[model samples]
Target: MFKFGNIYIIAAVAVIGGALFGFDISSMSAIISTQAYLCQFNQGGLDSDGKCVGPTPDVQGGVVAAMPGGSWLGALVSGFASDRFGRKTSIQIGAVIWVIGSVIVCASVNIPMLAVGRIINGFSVGICSAQVPVYITEIAPPTKRGRLVGFQQWAITWGILIMFFICYGCSYIDGTAAFRVPWGVQAVPAILLFCGLCVLPESPRWLAKKDRWEEAREVLALVHSHGNADSAWVRREMEEIREMVEFERQNADVTYFELFKPKMINRTMIGVFTQIWSQLTGMNVMMYYITYVFTMAGLASDDGTGVLLPSGIQFVINVVMTVPALLWMDRWGRRPTLLIGAFFMCLWLCVNAGLFATYGKPATGNHNAAVSMSITGAPAKAVIASTYLFVASFAPTWGPVSWAYPPELYPLRVRGKAVALATSSNWAFNFALAYFVPPAFANIQWRTYVIFAVFCAAMFIHVFFMFPETANKPLEEVEQIFDDTKPGAIKYIGTPAWKTRNTRAAVLKQERDQLASDEKIDAAAHKESVNA
Candidate 1:
């Protein structure tokens, strides 16, 4: 009897690290716009109109960009850590880092302190972001891998949403408590993650790679087969894992430089660029500086609570829409969903650029009542709606797919290194955008959306030509798609070998039967040789 319950528990507990990732996103986004944070860190002071004036574009960009700078370092280090320490231990280390970072952020009294804390937080996020999907993919059944790995993205969105509300509630406070309360609360999830990881089993594939065959067999049996070590399903799966690991050990030494080898470069590029494209989608700009977007869209610049409404809406939409995407991902396939999402995101961004160009006003240095009330009508609402539409388009597609895709792209030998490289690309671009958006908004205004719109269009063409479908394919089989050199391979990029559940079941049955036959033949040959 197969038991899914243990796998679900493991995934659920493991992905709490994602909540910390989310909390940092909304927590900083919320604070940067608050009067208390502005007053403390940005040299903000009361103007003639008695309203707070926040940090200049460069300062704000540096503060926001600092996290990903640390994240880039963290992502690079995580590959080595996960490979050496194991996945569960790597995640636990990240959780400890997160709690410490959160505490630092919550206690900060100045800009440097806050930046340091955020960088620490970013480092932890980088580790978790790289490891969580790989761990989940390694542990999950092939049929449920996409959905299970998807839980990381789901938790991230939930963390962002929950923190948005927490910050909203804090905005009512009079002083630094507005930011401190929310920052401190993030430690809760980090603590949960640290505690939970204490009991979770290490990834069986990782254990097998380390030549711990007995432990890997026991873990596979525990997770996949209700503790039945003799179950055919467990036996066949372990045999497949052992064969792959042995072949890798004999054929290649896992190294970062190996990822650039000719045979591996295509998969490496796919992983790296997929992550780069994900950051360029302008989603984080919306996430990190939503208040600024609302202000430009004609919402009252002074109305902190009102600005939060869109963040709230974005959170709700992200949570709601991601479910359908998860359900449809394995069924409809990865390539089509990504292609469709890029197209729609391009459409919405174009609309946003047009609306902002038509009705946009420059952001004043200080919030003014008159400026706030200047343009309140259809144009503002259109910009707001278009922003929501863009989020709606992304939540189901790029948001989740970014986290899910890279882990499945590489073989076990280089999976950690490949994912780290890809994830580092994500953070590198993430730093670029986080640094660019504030100044871009200040200078070009509406043209900012135009830049993202163009990127979205380019991404569609890239996905169509380069990305192959990995949905519903077993880890070993996914490599074959890239290895294929047939003339019409591009045309079949989005097609899966086993298209339905029944077909997949039939294929697994055949493999199991073949394995049993091979075992019998080997046993007979060994017996005859010994007798002779």
Candidate 2:
């Protein structure tokens, strides 16, 4: 078998797809404020400055959020590919799309054109968001699976951070053409990812389930030279995957309607609702508009930074937070982190928004600011600090753990479909938030916070009730729980929210496992030393 030591390098390579997702996500937010990006596309006619002139609130919202909206459509692509083509191929396809989309976006002439390009990029993001975890989970040694799969989230955050820096630097250029540089930089990574895919082995589990024994054997040999170690594991895994696929195939054709079937019904619910919760936690809303908040706070021009350094800092913070999944996720699992994260996110959101709400519209500028002139704080500082807290809350827990859970919980055959549904749901909700936020800010600016807080509270309750601890649990173990009709299956039905599997016992067990593993390694090293 391949040494466990090599898993990280494999994970880092596979998870570049996540980086593409993250890069596309925050990149467009930076471009929205640039006058050149918004130039001359008028619903009715152009204004004196050659910008579209109208009080088209909804239109502005759509334009502002098109990238996220597009992602929803793109996210569905993974389900189809993962189920049919395999996770690796789906990711490779996404890389191709990312490069094309980046070029189109960099060369865009108008807002609508830019939106088209963003939609393309969003498609790739949606696919990667679903595929990366599945790929990682399949390749990672089960002992470290949760943490390794978690690396995808960390990669995303890192991408966001890097893109933010690119955006921040490019924004200083003061023209639309200058903005192109940051957008263009994305192509480099996409191209590299595409090149990398040429040599990547398809997930052996995927190969085995497809009845491609030869391919699976070849792939396994590469991963592990110790006499077809991967092949042995694949045989065990394939039995289960084959059973699930046969069950799925015999039940009914794959349909949009099938997601609601009884066996899949619960998984579907978790996937979709959790995704909605992930977005509604108000993380994206903050990322989307915090720059405007900063400008209103007085960090940038009165016209607003559109996006700012404070926002960049948020990206950096998110990136930093995102990395922890690589180290802690295998230990902490999913539910506890999400529950705690939801509360913290909501708490900070309330605090930040409440502080801003205290200033009211006058200082922040209502659409009809002339009618209601109110004094507000130099929102820049408040905006910056609040967004940092918001993003920080996002990256480590809700952001990473959310994606982590679905892939781990679902069966190998169903994983892609499940993740696809969930990811698309996430993208859809993201679109809604992005599309709605500006107008909502225009309509009942402060009330939006109230809505988000409600969602956050709902998220906390939902996770505590429905979501269980997946930390250190094998994929088989998770499915076994779901498959079990025994008392342990019913055991947790009445269990108190906080007293679930992700307990101190679980945590201590994880620690002991780590220590024992280290001792084994040391012993192996000494034995090798003696042999040498």
Candidate 3:
């Protein structure tokens, strides 16, 4: 009944979905090295000397990879859920699933049970991750769209930071409780998100497609005009949405096959690859496996404090750096932001690779085989700083842009499904990398950074050649940029049309003014007819 009308409040509330993802990230990252976790889950348990060597590299990788594997399936289904149930309802469903998954995760007694619980939790994340951006983008005004959708990424960082510290604090508690407490605590945010969704409005575009025209107009007015349905801005937006929805209705028997058609394939490719590239940036390596990286850099200690504190600092940097991107995303535009981010990320990864290769040596210390090589002193410090810089590069750029971009590339008829497909690509790659990185560390050592650096380089080239500018354009206009038939369209680069700021607002204002002129002419004609 008390729906949030302010765009910022809506964004803040909806992005709790993203925070669920954040909670999962740190829940394991914070506790995997602890004695309780090692004893409870690792196959070998403690070594002959009673050192807390956790699971073998492959086993650990499987445990970490489980969530994303489940997420891949959940993402594939989210499109149907959102399209049929509505975005608000779909996110609510995800919240409920997260609570169930968290409970299972908290109650697990062994590795198989743990993996199963994480898989369930990952399913919820897949749904939330795919739909939160779509809901935010639909409600936000064009000029502020990027900033608002960017909130999802910001929420994710906060979730990571808050949960990491919670786990850090709990680490001091005696066995079992250290990890169980944080895993169980993850359910709290899901509860909040479920309750929050009760008061959130469904996407106005979704309302329009359902032929609930008056409801759509009211929602638009509520979001953009303080409940004034007669406002010109609201009217123009509703008109654009109605026209687009009407046109799409002609071919609205939407299927995944539709996305591969010539008119839509470019966006589908861009959307899917954009998500893939985001994971390949290796930011998640720093988030999920940073402790491992730090250990390899000779930062591990018996109590785990050495790596935990620095990992905490990286999460802080991630949260702080995202703020500016949310503020300036529209001004900077998507293509330039991604290109610049990829370039800097590549640079940082290269520095990390060179440092590790140059100064690292085979480990003989009390470390897991996963950390086969160790670097100390100056080179190790450089490795840590390089990781920080890599995160800084990704936080404001690929992190937010990747989530916001895909949902904006589709029509109302297929947005939920298209974004689901794209997000599944993200999860697929996420599963592979999460599973691969631990073993990679064991086998290749310094070459892990080299692989990611190469990915960042390829991503820079891809963004430059394939991604067109989408910033400040209405969702309806984005498809035209990919349409070769459109007289002045551009896909590989920006067109002259998108050069100006607030382009959507400007276009809407012109249309509003023209509507007034036409209405006045028709009124005058009707008056002359009555007189005659």
Candidate 4:
């Protein structure tokens, strides 16, 4: 069978899993405001102004939240599936599951049925989100790992952009077809992902865990050395992997409980909180309900294009800004990227909140009361621009780093389980916010942005003091850094090496020189033996 050996090809195909997540996101976001969707699922139906009035916020929230609720469970189960079935097979399973879910969603006749279908789709997303990063991280060279794993986030944004446009185009169609067409179309990516997995190699680290040494070496060479199994880089990587795998095998009985133990708790906290913080950045509120946000900002109207076109611009900005992270994440490193991202997101959110609070007024009859307050004129434009700024900050920073950082934190023994746990934290928070935000908009009004701003501020502080820089370090070395560094309960106590590490160029040069010294030593020893 023809197998894909190019790391770029593997990343592109595997990140279709991430695209599936993106598809699900825009699948609803694009259509939620359309008349057909409002007519089909909303009980109160369209108001005098043709906006969805609905039977309370929970119904809409539940419909949107179902996928993430299912995703939370799917992420938990993914660890077992990836560990037992291999990373390639786990993603294939998710793809198959997504097709089934999309079909149910497309065929749904009512809200209950729609929710069930979305839940199923969420399950698939949960699995793919947890494992795609794991697979990519395992195959990528240390120097390029950030860029490759970053493809997952990039794929997600592309999925969002593509699906949003697809649904946006379909929104012009009459009746329920507006939603059904796009919902059904979501199955296409999953089908492509399932077929793509046929030619993709399993994670080499997974192969090593199964005691398939030769297969592991072949995969490593395929990815890193253009299929030269005997290449020095390949040999060095395989040896390191073998050592770690064997070391982990000694305690192979490790389970979820082990993640909570003193030795592992710090990493577990970092991984879990990283995911939670990403969701709390309030970006999802923008993605899931941008139309509602724009309505509140007084930029939207009955025609929907006012909201759709601007929201489309936001999605475009999200996709375009992410390219920088893929290019420079390894060089710029994780710590600074996160800190800067968080601070700016917080600033933008604050700006958005102040604009809304200062210039907004109570929403009047037939003018989308769900948004509660409306801001017009200059303040409203500032609100919209601040949202774009917030997304730009998130796209290159927390967006990719959250996914890339967690998988690098664990040892081979429990990597799958640990990553699953971290991703589950993401879904759990996602489910809550998806359900909570609509009602929050109606009740708390501008204060919603205030809450997200606070989350961004707290996360900035946390990253500054807690997150270790993992850029350019081998996965094995990342574990050692965590062990070697001490965590303190207060500020200015036990600052981490991430604050002091040399530049990426210096680090790579040091490793290359060490490898040369080792090779020369081995050559001299062999020559002495031959002479004797």
Candidate 5:
């Protein structure tokens, strides 16, 4: 067995990518309410209320919605970058973009400049989220894979928690500095990542695809094998990748549109559904709008540019709730954990919605009559509990698995493109929710959460039907599963669905049989020595 620390170090590399992903999410959330950051050079000066003077409701929504919309473009580009350049490079590139984007927001004297920075950061976060888990899952050993990569989800929740706290601490400062402090805080980790990523070895499997066998072998040995490994083993892996890609290439001619081919239809379905399943769970909406939820619940009040709760304390509490899941997931398996989490998420959303529906009332201080008159006292406490439960339920399941599964489900040839489409869909849907949510909050209030509860209920059904157990299978084996559906059909791939499916099962069984043989041999050798 390998030492635990080395595995952790390897895991940390991937987690840092996740960290950047989380950092942007939290940072953007922190930045959104800061009117100073939203000030416009073109719009002249501050209003009588001392907020940015420019833009009515619709125009302001556009400005607020800009970054989430830009994420669609980021996810689209990540597909090509991860599939073409390499996963590690995509993450590194994202780190650089994140730093640039963070600086733009923090330094901005007007809303337009902050908008540009937000878009840049949004792009980096989208790409970082898609690429990090794909890289980590590919590298981890089967036995510990779940535990290690689950860190990504755990990291994200903790990141959100920290950002909330930062927003809280920064809230204590008055005026422009209130917003700038939290925006600038993001630069620290991102700068660290840009420096740190340069030291990491490229993902070996990605290198193998480029025909760089030696580099691939060296990387594999560093991260995977226990100290030393046979070169033939490395060659064997390359051969496997070559066969899989060549098989996919010969069938589809390696074009991006070939993802829609008859054989790949299920693979396509899995990608789309899993992504849909992720966002539909209501996590993003909650993440996007929880501060308002908190405000309505009596958690905090507006302090100049942002809300005033102790964000750091809240983040610490959130991390404590989330980090435990990283340990339990492998013990429980992906499906059970997801089912459990979904039930709780549905429950949380219902309670949260119900509380708002029943008892929500307006506050005395805030500007908008709608918000000012919103729920106070016990109703606020319920909202706080609702936010906690929402974060807790998602921490172990939907959050990480959605990020983890896409690359595993698709083989190398189509993995990049399929992931691109899935992430793009995620960002597109996110843009819709983020765009509409604040308005929904401003106008519909409790009804907004009622809608989220409905979406979460639907996701529960989809995840139960479709998510695969991809915990252990290599890409070679995963491709063979798709190839099996057609026999000679893997060549032409127009065979009956029944026939192609049987092929997938047979190939997987063959791989399992080989693993069984090795295990049997080891057992026999141990028994023989004991008898002697």
Candidate 6:
């Protein structure tokens, strides 16, 4: 068996790019409330209470939305990069892009420059988002794949957590230094990721797909079998991979258009909608506009500490909750985990909406006064508690599952393109939500939770009906689940793959034993006949 440590190391290094993704998410939100950031970029000056009156709703939306727009372009192009240059190389390229973007953002003097920098960073994040999971899935052993791939999500949360605290610390600084310090810190992860990738092995599956069998075998031996090139387990796994690759090469002309075929369309939609639903869950709303939520909840609207405290709590909850998810995701299956998470998310959203509706007052056109009085005491505390619960529910479910599911659905032929499309769908919807939230809060106030609550309800239905159980299945076997004409296909799709895999493994062992017995008997007979 592979050394588990090596597997984690590889996965960890590859997923550092996810840190950059998380950093960007929190970095903007963190600084938006700072007087320096607002005075530099926004039109209106500081209010009577000294809170910086910032960009208009439309401008704010565009600035916040720009990264996802860039991410969309980055994700679309990443498919080609992954297919052409290889997954490792694509990730390295993304790291370089991220550093470039980080510099621009750190040095930005105007809103346009900041937007450009965010777009660049967004592009880089898109590349990482699409390729990292695919690379992890291809390299990880079947039993450990879910948790291994889930590392990206874990890194993402860690990134958010670190950036949140960094921004909090930076809040003490006056002038442009407040924002610049946090913005500049992003380069560290990007650099480390690039260096890490330089020393790592290329994905064995990608090597094998290109007919580089010897190289692929070497990688699999080193990575999966602890340098035992002749180990039966490694041989068996390599053989299966080779056969699958050869079969696809001979039978199918793989292309982007192949994803649209009847056999593949359902799987494609499953990938796309998984991401769409993830963005609609209002997780980013919390990640991006949490200060606003806290403000409305009766926390100090003007103090950075008010935003920092709840976000720090969120970061802790996100990290803690994900551990159980990684532990249980393979056991519980993707659909059930996602379904349960969505149900709770809906419930929490409804509770949040109700709390806000009951206790929250309408904005009086004075930003500071409106938030300062709208919430307080027991009702305010309940709103904060519900927000945490919502995050807790999502951390274990949609947060990681969205990243894990898409790569598992498509065959090798179109896997890169399919994931790219799915990731783009994520960014597209993310753009809509990120752009919409500021205005949404501006216009609808507490009612915004109601919209997300409805979306959560819809997502629950979608997962129950459309998503099949993929946990513990080999990538090849997962492909078979889509074949309608295959006998017992319905049962295969509906049931957890782990159970079926166990049964199949047992049957195969019995067959092997029986064949060995027959061979021994035949050898004994031959010896007797020769002696006679």
Better of 2 and 4 by TM-score: 4
Q: Residue 4 in candidate 2 has what lDDT?
A: 30
lDDT of 1 by residue, 1-532 (tens): 2233399898888888777878878887777766777777755467766757667777788888888888888888999999999988998999999889889989998878988998999999889888988899899987677777888888988999999999998899998898899989999998888888777889999999998989888889889867767666677799899888878888756788988776787888889998999999998878898877776565544535667766688778878888887776666567777888999999999998887776766555565221222234898888788888998999889888888888888899889878988999999999999988887876677788899999999999888877876776789877766654543232223454223122345556766786688667657867888999
Residues 387-502 of candidate 2: C-alpha lDDT, one tens digit per residue? 67777777888887777777776766567777788888888988888888777766676667778988898889888777766666656556655432443243234354355575
Alpha-carbon lDDT, every model: 0.81, 0.69, 0.86, 0.87, 0.65, 0.82
Roughly what TM-score does model 5 have, to 2 decimal places? Answer: 0.82
Q: Rank the candidates by TM-score, best first.
A: 4, 3, 6, 1, 2, 5
Q: Model 4 over residues 138-250: C-alpha lDDT tens digits?
A: 88888889999999999999999999999888878888888899999999999999999999998999999999999999998788767878666677888899899888877
Candidate 3, residues 7-67: lDDT per residue as tens digits? 8889999999999988988887888877778878767656656777778889898999999
Q: Which residue pairs in model 6 clash with each other?
A: none
Candidate 6 total steric clashes: 0
Which lDDT tens digits does candidate 6 get at residues 1-532? 2323388889999999888888987887777766677778867666667777777666777888889888988998999999888889999999999999999999999989999999999999899899998899888866677788888888888998899889989888988899999999989999999988887888888888888888788888888656867656567778888888988787665677877776777788889999999999999868887776776665644554567777778888988898887886766668888889999999999998998888877655445321332677898889899999999999989988888889998888788889989999999988888888887777777788899999999999888766877777788877888764443233335454333322335434654785576556657867888999
Question: In terms of TM-score, how similar is model 2 to the real structure?
Answer: 0.83
Candidate 2 at residue 283, lDDT?
Answer: 79
Task: Note the residue pairs that clash in candidate 4.
Answer: none
Model 5: ten consecutive residues of lowest lDDT: 495-504
Please list all clashing residue pairs in model 2, or write none if there are none.
297-378, 297-379, 297-380, 333-471, 362-374
Question: Which 10-residue span in candidate 2 carries the lowest summed lDDT?
Answer: 364-373
Model 4 vs. true fold: TM:
0.94
Question: Candidate 6: misplaced stretches above 4 Å?
Answer: 1-5, 251-253, 301-303, 368-373, 484-532
TM values, all candidates = 0.90, 0.83, 0.93, 0.94, 0.82, 0.90
Candidate 4 residue runs with Cα over 4 Å from true position:
49-52, 367-369, 484-503, 510-532
